[model samples]
Target: AVMDFACPGLMGDLTSFRKIYAAPIGKAGERGASEEEKRIGAARRAELGRLTQGFIHARKADEINASLLPPKTEYVVFIRLTPTQEDMYIRALKQKSLQSMLGRCGKSDAEAPTSVLGVIQNLQKLCNAASLVEASDEFDIDASSKL
Candidate 1:
């Protein structure tokens, strides 16, 4: 029926189109739709399958493999955090637990993120470089776990 106004008889007259396709599909979209409603939806969907069948084919495995790009370079370097940094991370984790228990674990409009996820993110920043959170005047890359 919507097609009558939307595309003017493109799918046929609104009444017939609604009875054949739109109504069945619309009923299927609802939560807890009846078995009969679902069956009708499947039948209607099957009827329209050919219109998109060609576009639904999968890509070949060979094509997928051929499309992959090789990595340019890779290296691994490890650095240990200072004791103070580890202590700060532990304190943040404990604070995050308390905040979660109080139903105050998500970011607020005026605050830096303080949720459990946010606190974990802060810990990650600390691992990368303490300067990210502490705003140190002199950043020491050699001190970061990621460097």
Candidate 2:
């Protein structure tokens, strides 16, 4: 049998996450993947490789992040993508969510995170759509037309 494996931690959690996508192999792969599919797979794998290779300014970045963090807070971004794209994607997601949240709050000023824990919880739900917290959103379920 052809040997190949999927690399985990595509989104986050740093360790042993189940793979969402994987490449194919040999004749079966030839039958399975068109040229574009193969190119996309190669691009994805390359992105993962680039991330696993390590960041040059990681220590500085970590130090800065820690300086802003509260004591004993566990914050980790486990992205399996290129540094630039990953940063952009996260920035976009944060902007989208926080803008809505702040708009909902109706205060133009950015408040000093009164509840870091709550922020984390909300973020967890945002990241992991399968999260129990997400499933438990009564308002969202009630609001959805399909539900």
Candidate 3:
């Protein structure tokens, strides 16, 4: 069985997985792949897929042991952000770097900067506690809205 904490798609035929593995190793990394190289790589990948058909069998958790698992339920809860959290969140959203990243949304060819996830995490931290995102020693614990 294959498992991943963050990316379960690693077990499937995902384009992101292909992109990660197709990147050249050592000095000739991802940046070295030219348009022609990419085309050839795509052709080779297609041939490999054709040759490896039916070689893998994937099973889901439910399929393995349905009796041991319970039915799934999702819950959504809403809470108002504290004034401090709202202020910090708004400031984070207004930052030029974040604004530029957000502006790229909905573009088919736009590549998301790796830092986007970090920026989002920081924003989430800010909502959880001002101390998490702020470096100041004078940060108040009461600034956390979730508490």
The estimated TM-scores of all candidates read 0.40, 0.21, 0.46
Better candidate number, 1 or 3, judged by TM-score: 3
Tens digits of lDDT, candidate 1, 1-147: 443455565567657778988899889878999999999898888875654355456679777766795644778987667776777666765775545634653436344343455666777987765667786687666565555
Ranking by TM-score: 3, 1, 2
List per-prediction Cα lDDT, in the order shown: 0.68, 0.48, 0.65
TM-score: the better of candidates 2 and 3: 3
lDDT: worst 10-residue window of model 1: 105-114
**Best-performing candidate as measured by lDDT:** 1
* Cα lDDT tens digits for candidate 3, 1-147: 233334354445555445543442222334677777666666656654654455546578779767777777899888777787788889888889888887776665336655676787898888667777878878565774445
Note the residue pairs that clash in candidate 1: none
TM-score of 1: 0.40
- State in Å the error of residue 26, model 1: 3.9
Best by TM-score: 3
Question: RMSD to native for every prediction?
Answer: 9.0, 23.3, 10.9
lDDT of 2: 0.48
